[model samples]
Target: MARTRTLLTAGAFALVTALLPTITTVGAAAADRDGPGPVAVSESRGQLTVTVPPGHGGPGYRLLIDEKTLGVRTVRAGRTVLATNPAGGFAFGDQHATSVTTWSYAAGTLRIAAASTAPADTVAVAITPTADRYDLTWSVAGAPAGARTVSYQLSSAGHWYGGGETSEGAAQPYPLDAGQVSEPDFSPASYLMMEPYWYTSSSVGNYVRTASPMDVQINKSASGLGDFTIKSTDSYASTVFVESTPSAVYQDYVEVVGKPSKSDATPAEIAQPLWNSWAQFYTAIDQNKVLDWAGKLHAAGLGGHTIQLDDKWESNYGNLTFDPKTFPNPKAMSDQIHSMGYHFGLWTTLWINLDSANYAYAKDHGYLLAAAADSTKPCTVTWWNGTAGIIDLGKPAARDWYTGNLHQLMSTYGVDGFKFDTRFFDDSCAPAAGVQAGDYQRLGAEMADGFDLQGAGVRVHWGNQKYGFVIRAVDAGTSFPELRTTLRRSMAISTDGYPFVETDMIGGSLGEPAPTKQVLVRWAQAASLMPLMYSSTSPLGVVDHTTGKPVTYDPETVQLYKNAIARHGRLSDYLQAQARKSVADGTPIIRPVFFDFAADQRFYTTDDEWMLGPSVLAAPVLSDSPTRTIDLPAGAWFDTVTHRVITGPRTLSAYPAPLGVTPAFVRLGAPGAATAIAALSHQS
Candidate 1:
């Protein structure tokens, strides 16, 4: 039966190959060459075919497959089978370009070799197919003279359609620019040539413009999805150029289908109650001390949602065992927190300590990435847990083992969610030497997959840049639904359409001093519109290193934070409802100034002012100056603080902005409203 099944699969493959003209033989023998150089045409699984033109001069050869021109490459006569960029691109002189190459077969591989008369320059390129994507590897014989960079363009077809690039290497749906015009006929092919810088600027400044018509439109009526069609153009053939430089343009396009309904539960929603913390809860304050703080917050009307027992709960950093002395009875403590109306959250990174019991198992099983003998060597950097090694999440058994341990922690501690941190560190530290380059890419994808399969809502911190190939897997909306932090401009951009987008309350990192009264008000006013909000303060009360003093909040500053928290709590239901609408309909909580003032060209470049939903416009005083001039599009706006009505398309006169005030206004008749000012104050 087994033999028959194998034969049946082989026969099925053969049948498919016969029907598909693109399928070529794998590992076929090379033909003889009589000219100055060998011009070989090789096909792989029929989906991709490589043809090296005769007398291939210069340092490399060009790749043409499946009627699509992939990129140009440097070739060597012998010694190396393939030489190409780990990241894809074409380089001319010193310039690097962005582009994409599409593969046909759902699962297959391709390799191309070239022989050149130039002994100094040799190159080989290899392509391997996965279930959903392709892996490319390139090798060069000797280093090239002068600077080299890769330049290329991708065909926006299938899932490779319209999207924006992030400094983190993932492509996300571009935000809708109200006044900004998209080219007509802006299909995927037309916009695909518009190369947005992958890991630097998130704006359209890096895109390419052509004489041909470009047809593309951003779909925000539903969840943020980009649908585009590229009309065939006669001017330029669909080609990807490769050059050598700072890096290669390795492009990854993800086919993400938006949620059908806005009310659908996000990973954060499902995992909110499961949220746990490290030993920070106890270490920040003693058991009695935290109980007192928790009681105070409860009394202050500040409800505790989740009190995560951070790192200190463990016996040691690397040892996953509980610190019996500190935790005493963790179950009792967990029950106490629950009784106080808060869930539990825990933190764990992938690094394991040599002293831990799991260390022997990991070392013996070939899971640890460090030598047991030398702990001083920077196996991975020295983490919180002294002398730790990263666990190989790439291996199936290793992943299973890690998952089982996590499950054990949850079951034993009655924990809600796991704050999975540093899983990406695996990219830098592989368990074994000589691992294939493709294997490295696969490792990131596998780790993301493993986290999803583990059945726990994983919370990912920053570090999206390391695994450049994995889109949104970091912030990609796959592994984590809610992000930990949303920096200033990031909040404005990401919240444009993404639902469940949360930002830190009032102040971001607890280590920094709390915001001034005015800054606090502005931040709170902005945060109130977001789906998720929290107040995070450093428990250590240590002075900031840069400022060199413990952060002391003035009475006014404290009052403002308290007031904002109180207001947010009072309006939580309404705000959450709006957030639900946003999640459901792709409406942004924190809209850009341009969205509301689309017709006004002046607001296109303005980043300081933004709309907090449809009803309110928040113009924060970012500069240290006493007053700032604001550009308001034609509209009747009423000041929330003073109830003063001001007409649009005019500059508002100077107003006293001493440390406590922000120039914010509410739109006259926009729906879904909330304001710091009373309605009667805005009477006609």
Candidate 2:
């Protein structure tokens, strides 16, 4: 029998529906009227099953209209252990679980009881079903002594996209599924981003609602479907959102997290490119060097609005002042940067080197974290820079003092904002702080509220959406493969909800071997299509290390590079508009193509191509090949280069993308179609 009790809690779900004003349906399911409606529930011997229509069809579940599977689910519970150290290392002990003892469904919720060993006598789970999603919570009657691992079994098959940043070198073939992710082998490093949310191509999304260090693993069964095992240190609740399309699932998540806060970056900031000192000069940057780079950037007709001084700008790590030796007359440098029509951004971290002049004062004042071993002494941790004392941002006084120092620096030196840099967890000193790494990161970021803040070495959380600053890709090397890696990194991070995305420098960081002319031009073309195109290596000055001479692009390559920036400039308004919409809802400005075409499996593996808002699709060449194939999801696509409208589901094989051109298509009837098409036409 089917029960039709609505899942809208008097206050909780009512708020969710109000936030999600627009609900799009996928496949053949009946269009959801208003917000989500009641879900179907049925019970069997000792077990209960709830069904919500999936966005797409699958073989293992009950069929719905258009052959779509009604996603079925059952919950289970287990136990595990979490250990962390000062070196930002974490380990999880072996895990064990118990089967469901009994289950009952009533008033839109399914409750399951389970038996556990000592420390935890019993475990109870309550799953409340809504229109196309469910909220699951678990609790123990007795202390588990360790962590609890909750899991859900879904009879669906598809690739997984979210769940934080992709591990380094694991970028291609899109989704992290089956063979790509496994238990024990797939460790917390994969979850370093600490974003415990994942949405799949099958239109199922899982969000582990806990800040505690947790491990999320997805593995395919022999039958092709998969299991989501989320182990957290504390008993917690998680939500499972099902929709007809991945985009709807993402929107549902955004509603829960709330829209981007007003403090997010301004429209002008979103539209302009950022130039950083790290990629070009690294720690060797000086006052004169910055000015020279700014002049060179201007001469190239690249009006980058922000020039960031990355690592080594500070007199010492966490000192929050310019190094006098490298940046003599810091105030004058800031004024010159501002006079040149740019925002001066300084890099910062919480690590205060013991050698720093202010270290003793901070330690004496209770601003520094105490060593875990000796509460009387300040903690010392070694990092790339050196061993340093970390500021205890968890303390309100410490945060206020830190904020005041930055404000003083900015006011005295004409600094417009800061690029906050620090590992998500850095406790080389084994600090005895009670604050989790994620909390500390959020607190540190909050101190930069209202400033032109950007995150480099930080974690991405849904709550931080309000900060509205750009989150950049990790450093990239100067290789064609690395260029592709940069693209995958952006797509992964963007889909994880850092909407205002920025790529590293044009030709990769200067730390690696210089890119050849071809690689540099190709990288420039690809980065131009992202939300923010960052450049550091001077287009006119980068030396070709292989030849020991300036990397000189031919007329075609040069034109292609210039054309990329021109196209980006022309579409700036469209990008800004999409960014605003993302703030209003929870959608990303630059996202995987699957977000729109989830029913089409062909796009599930797409990593190189991306959708810039709804109107434009960019297919930048990411390899050394002179030509590449292009796959267009169902749509009326207007090819920018040929000026022809090609209807697809169609595949354009061996698309002629010469040295100086990238393939981009503008959807004919999307909201910003006219503006995007016009931009492409102007570029062509």
- Identify the leading candidate in terms of lDDT: 2
Number of clashing residue pairs, candidate 2: 6
Q: What TM-score quantifies how close candidate 2 is to the native fold?
A: 0.82
Residue lDDT tens for model 1, 389-444: 66665466766777787777778877665444454333234344544322432354
lDDT of each: 0.40, 0.64
Residue 473's lDDT within candidate 1 is: 18
Task: In model 2, state the lDDT of residue 51.
Answer: 49
Expressed as tens digits, the lDDT of each residue in 56-153 for candidate 2 is: 32111221110011112322111101011111111113333344444455555666665443334555667665555667676666554455554333
Using alpha carbons, what is the TM-score of model 1? 0.53
Winning model by TM-score: 2
Clashes of each: 73, 6
lDDT of 2 at 605: 79
How close is every model to the real structure, measured as TM-score? 0.53, 0.82
The 10-residue segment of model 1 with minimum total lDDT is: 197-206
Q: Where does candidate 1 stray beyond 4 Å?
A: 1-289, 366-387, 430-486, 492-499, 504-526, 538-558, 570-574, 581-588, 596-599, 621-628, 656-663, 668-684
